[model samples]
Target: MIVQFKDVKDLTSSPAKSEKIHVYKSGENKGKTRKLNAKPARTGILPVSEKTVWTWVREGKFPKPFKMNGRTVWRLSDVETWIAEQESKATILKEGA
Candidate 1:
């Protein structure tokens, strides 16, 4: 049985566990399988929240995401560059100390 947000009596109210709610996870999500890099030059996985993504992009610290049809995505190269940069900086600080 599928329920909608509107069906809830109150937004602040909690529902009984027996209500038969169904959450889902796609089969691919259950494993350590990596995402298909369909567009290697224009797609990636970034460890960031939406808020921080936008901020970093605006500040030029992050790569500007590329558009696929209409959806924006980051390039794996850009993400790797950022990660390597961070690691380099960390090493420098450690060596300085």
Candidate 2:
């Protein structure tokens, strides 16, 4: 069977449990994978300042951002994964120490 979505809402609304939802910008990359700017990136699940984020990126501790029309953006998934890894590492360290 084939299904057709009439609008963005339709597409965003009922994803399967195993499916991953991707939020994207409205312009050229609309409906594609989402990208977060410095501000949003800093305000994510594990909040951190842009400066710290950049420092971590430079030190190979965080995900790198890609250029989007002269603007730098980090993939939301990548940020989430980084946060998860950090939490996992912290848990391991706490357990060990």
Candidate 3:
């Protein structure tokens, strides 16, 4: 028989600091806090560190982030597409192996 287990530390870890609570300052939901859905490109959507994200960008492995209102950001669609492509590639490699 064979069994698999995830790292206990990983299971017990809290959400990353990148996941932040956003407070509505002036909208109808003013004073209400919501989990931020969009994260800055510097922090990256993946579990990787900020430096890794920049390194990927420099290496041309990741999409380039753009400045919007002086804040750097990546398009959600682009990020989603990149993730899908990575998944497909992984599937291909697994099948080939």
| lDDT tens readout by residue for model 2, 1-97 | 4432121121122312333457776988787884343221112344444456667879998767777676666666666677788889999999999
The lDDT per prediction is 0.52, 0.55, 0.64
TM-score of each: 0.49, 0.52, 0.55
Question: Looking at model 3, which ten-residue stretch has the lowest summed lDDT?
Answer: 4-13
Model 1 Cα lDDT, one tens digit per residue, 1-97: 5422211111113222322323345664553444332321222244344566678879998767766666565555566677789889999999999
Looking at model 2, the pairs that clash are none
Choose 2 or 3, whichever is better by TM-score. Answer: 3
lDDT of 3 by residue, 1-97 (tens): 4332222122122344477788999979999999966533332247665566678889999878777676676766676677789999999999999
The true-versus-predicted C-alpha distance at residue 29 of model 2, in Å, is 45
- Give per-residue lDDT, candidate 2, residue 13: 28
As a TM-score, model 2 comes out at 0.52
Highest-TM-score candidate: 3
- Of the two candidates 1 and 3, the one with more favorable TM-score, higher being better, is 3
Is candidate 1 or 2 superior in TM-score? 2
Q: Estimate the TM-score for candidate 1.
A: 0.49
- Least accurate stretch of 10 residues (summed lDDT) in model 2? 4-13
Model 2 residue-pair collision total:
0
